[model samples]
Target: MSDSNSILFFVLGCIATLALIALIFKHRFFRQQKYLPKRVITPFERKMFLRLKEAFPQYHVLAQVAFSALITSEDYKIRQRFNRKVTDFVLLNASLDVIAIIELDDPSHIGKEQEDAQRDAMLHEAGYRVYRFTQIPTLAQLRKTISG
Candidate 1:
């Protein structure tokens, strides 16, 4: 072949190779992957959830609530501190207003009292009632704690 034709074929070959590589990378990187379903709440959390529901049938009890969903701040850094943290439960009144923030402290929270206190302070600063329970309380106790 002539010099011009040889150069043209070489350019076309380079373009084709690049296109093939891109397609392979796109398929490998962007393809959908399978995700398995798992229980949203643990067995221990489920027990507390049931108790809360029974204690306050008229109110809404939400489990595994995100801090971001509950509160926000104009300062991004201050907000970031609690943005990714998750609360054990949030109780909302009949009007859909958040009444209280509930945290069920298990053995895992033994050494994290300071961290938990800071989190509680942040929520308290936002005008939320924070309740930390080491064990599930009785119906009367729940009513007393939430009401007063």
Candidate 2:
């Protein structure tokens, strides 16, 4: 073979080898990386969750519930609005029917009243009751608020 042809093949061979090594390294890097487990609810939410469970032993108290699980619509736009939104807690009866949507308004909820009202309105329009609290209520208070 001519020197020029031999040199071209050598360069091409080096490029192919480097490309293969790069592909292997990229695959290994991604494979070695993994997602770690995370807490599903915050510390405050955790405390409230326990309280809800204690307060409403007759009903199911679900925390960090996606709105999608509770409601759906035929309109894509309507679905888009709530698909990404999650509720702090959802109370369900023995028949698994949604009784009410509970929202704990911590410091994070400050200045979001308008947005929260809109969300609550949407839930109300869908025939679901919504309860908002700045702090965890006592067991009697919870029963009174929910039952009334």
Candidate 3:
């Protein structure tokens, strides 16, 4: 082969190799990034699910029990005279209308107990229960927690 042709072939080979590497990385990275099924769930929701998956693996079975079992009225918007507007998560058998509000807490909850408390009271007065899980509960735990 002529020197020019050989060099061109080498360049093409390098480009192809780089493309393959990029494809591989993209595949490997996002393959594990699959979130839950609901497309409407926000980034916070997905983060919550991921956290739950990580922290409470034992609850995997429970998490799948039923959406109703864990969250009775997810994203339930409430406009109360208390000047507190909020969404609700009702635990299935908790007997309370809203036993928990699964807030995906990060550094915010560390020193913001007051803020959390205010939110809790808003739901409380509205006749609901509240259980704050700093981290996400695993599917198994979520299943059992809601089911049982």
Q: All predictions: root-mean-square deviation over Cα?
A: 4.8, 3.6, 11.9
- Candidate order (lDDT): 1, 2, 3
Cα deviation at 35, candidate 2, in Å, is 2.7
Which scores better on lDDT, 1 or 3? 1
**Which scores better on lDDT, 2 or 3?**
2
TM-scores of the candidates are 0.76, 0.79, 0.38
- What residue pairs clash in candidate 2, if any at all? none
User: Which residue window of length 10 is worst by lDDT in model 2?
Assistant: 28-37
The numbered model that scores best in TM-score is 2
lDDT of each: 0.92, 0.90, 0.54
Cα lDDT tens digits for candidate 2, 3-104: 999999999999999999999999988676478888988898888888889988999988888888888899999999898899999999999999989999
Q: After best superposition, candidate 3 residue 11: deviation in angstroms? A: 60
Using TM-score as the yardstick, the better of models 1 and 2 is 2
Sequence-dependent TM-score of model 2: 0.79
Candidate 1 stretches with Cα past 4 Å from truth are 1-34
Q: Candidate 1 — what's its lDDT?
A: 0.92
Model 1, residue 74: C-alpha shift (Å): 0.7
Q: Which stretches of candidate 3 lie over 4 Å from their true place?
A: 1-44, 49-85, 88-100
| lDDT digits (tens) for residues 1-148 of candidate 1 | 9999999999999999999999999999988777878898888888889989999998999999999998899999999899889999999999999988899999999999999999999899889999989998998999899887
Per-model tally of clashing residue pairs = 0, 0, 23
